[model samples]
Target: MAYCKYHPLTASTYHCESCQINQCDHCVDDDPEHPEPRCFVCAGAVDSLGATDIAPFWRRLDRAFHYPMNKQTMMLIFIASLLASLGAFIGGITGFCLSLIVTAITTKYSFLCLQRTTDGGVTAPDMNEAFSGGFKIILHIIFILIGISLMIVGVERLFGGLASVLFSIFWMVCLPAVFINYARFEQIGPAINPIEIGRLVFTLGGAYLLLLLFIAIMIASVGTLHQILEEQVYFFSAILQSIVSYYYLIVIFHLMGYLIFQKQKILGFTSRLESSEHSAGRSSQNRMLANIDVLTKEGQFDGACATFKQGLQAFPTSYELHSRFFDFLYGLNKLDEIDAFWPTYLDLVGRQGRENQASTAYQRLLLLDKHYQPTSPDVRYRIAQACFEAGKSVLVVKLLNGLHRDDPQYKALIPAYELMAKALDDLPNKREQAEKLRRMMRQLAHHST
Candidate 1:
């Protein structure tokens, strides 16, 4: 349970042997270009010292039971349950497809809950995050479940029902470990490896048994709810049952994820949260960028600008470096330098589809020169679209005005025309202009064909 050298309240995730200092995830150098996390000061390889201060999963049963009680998590449960209910009520090919979607979504979200919980995300994750990695996890879980089930069935056939029952019990005990491994590594082989499961089960000792007890209770509670609602309307009953099952499903996964988090040190596992934070640190170009940030903060604009000049040369295409440099120059009121840099900065942000940043940068440029226009038609098209989406219709029209004469070679003419038409329609007393743009769109379509 070593505390961070800089932030005493926070648990240290890495230790710099070179600096002989304990650094939290935030303080460690997270530059992705580097092979490993480096010390902020020394730029030397640091060893991962996993968090040891977390309470065991059993000790936090109250919080574990309420983990899925958040608005986001409950909403997921309701949506999945609603789909499951419809599938059960319809009971056909369409129903089967609906049911399959529910299963996939539920399984994906449950694993995400586990992973996020392991990463120190106390609250339930949003829907966007659950589907971020796609349905790959669904396949992995299916494989693990099928492989384990087959092993149990094979034991019954080769030995006896009693022997099979014993093996089932043994597997039931190791189930949490199996899932933790699966969530941790996201590979079926490590998850199903008997040796790995056995090692994990042994390492956790009595706490593993406590986790098993909670898991059994959570599983049985779902069945108990079904029985209690046996006399209710079938459709409504199905929905309730599904919701309860998903609620406990998330809780179970959260518990397993927390178990890993609590015992990360002994398990030699770095939770995803720590790893991601560690990686999000300054990059290989961090030293210069960091020095620039420090210098800018200290009101050493001259030195910061010097470093920015050097950094921009070294990492010419780096959006982050360019962004920070742009901000610094703007703060110093270096209008000429900003004018020279604006097009490149806008293009960098536009190419990345960073709509918000591009729009903000465009506004910043607008301040410098009221008639500011990017030299590149592509950059204009992107920023105009971004402004239009942000309800800056005037900006959109201004950006796209006279584009045909200026950059007729622009490949995105059709979309640009369509966007201009829409923006025109949105503006007051511009219907005639909008219709004219619409006619141009028709003419363009006719020509392209």
Candidate 2:
């Protein structure tokens, strides 16, 4: 949740270890040609800050449960479960192979869920994507499972039952990491590598422990439910178990995905959420603003001015663009240019009902050139009205003092006189003048009638 160094309002998702500064996604160089993100400041590879913007898996259990409740996911689960149930009903070596195929297919979908979720795509993927390439992950998972079983059996034979029990428990705890690693690299070697699994688990730390706790609870719950169904209704219990297993598979994979999302920076994966946020920050106005900042810093004032002018043209109503340009002009001491820009900026802010901005801009222009005044009668009146409301009685009187001489045909003359009269009434010795102004207002109203 660290804010970007350049734009304080935006959150940073990448950091430069060399510069020790956090950057928003859009502020860094994300060239597709270079897989790693490069820093805009030093062109060095940046570290991901990870999915700090998203909630942790433990905290989002409701979402995890509902993730597979979508129509497509439900349909997939039902169909897969029915196939597996049919395989069980067939009851032979052929039936066993059929069931294995169904298991592999479902496991593939579950792996797909984990992969997509890790990439910040929380929604269940289309059925087609799930079926397309999940068979490979199933093979990797089988290898991992077989490897764990053999290692446990070897430990029991060499070091006795206690050692085997400990090894079994260790592998049980490392199961999630094993699957996560496989999903990340999509390779059997890395998925089964002890170092890779340990690194991921260590990085996840307490959150991983929490994940294990949830997994244990889910497993126990599912087992108890299966037992209850088996005892009460022997006929449909297998089908029910298949349905429940598929549902929980989606949920667990989704939870794993969220875990990766929350730590994607450490995991070195860009998430859908991060990509989308970066894209959003690259709007034309923002790009222009960034360019202007760069041009100004490089001492290219003319080019910066040109870019700033183009930004104003492209996004005339952008308050940030106008404000930044005004500050830039003020910094350069370009009083003449600022004077030229002030009226348009003031009118724009006023039309947007920004009374404070209009008032502040006028006051700043006045300080730069005491004789400065907005030529438009409406702009002058609006500023005066704002001043009066802000209790700047003297400034209001100065602003409206000779309205008739300046613009005798100004439309809002009655309101101007009324505001002037109110300001005068607030002064100590101007009570008589205020009374005279009120009489003038009444005379003007009567004449208009």
Q: Which residue pairs in candidate 1 have backbone atoms (N, alpha carbon, C) closer than 3 angstroms, thus clashing?
A: 30-281
Where's the lowest-lDDT run of ten residues in candidate 2?
Answer: 272-281
lDDT of each candidate versus the true structure: 0.80, 0.80
Clashes of 1: 1
lDDT comparing candidate 1 with the true structure: 0.80
Candidate 1 RMSD computed on C-alpha atoms after optimal superposition onto the true structure: 18.1
Error of 2 at 176 (Å): 2.8
**Top-scoring candidate (TM-score):** 2
Candidate 2 residue-wise lDDT, 327-442, digit = tens: 88877878778767867787677778776775676677777778776666776787888888777888788788888688978879889988999999998899999999888878
Q: Candidate 2 lDDT (Cα, whole model)?
A: 0.80
Model 2 TM-score is 0.69
**How do all models score by TM-score?**
0.54, 0.69
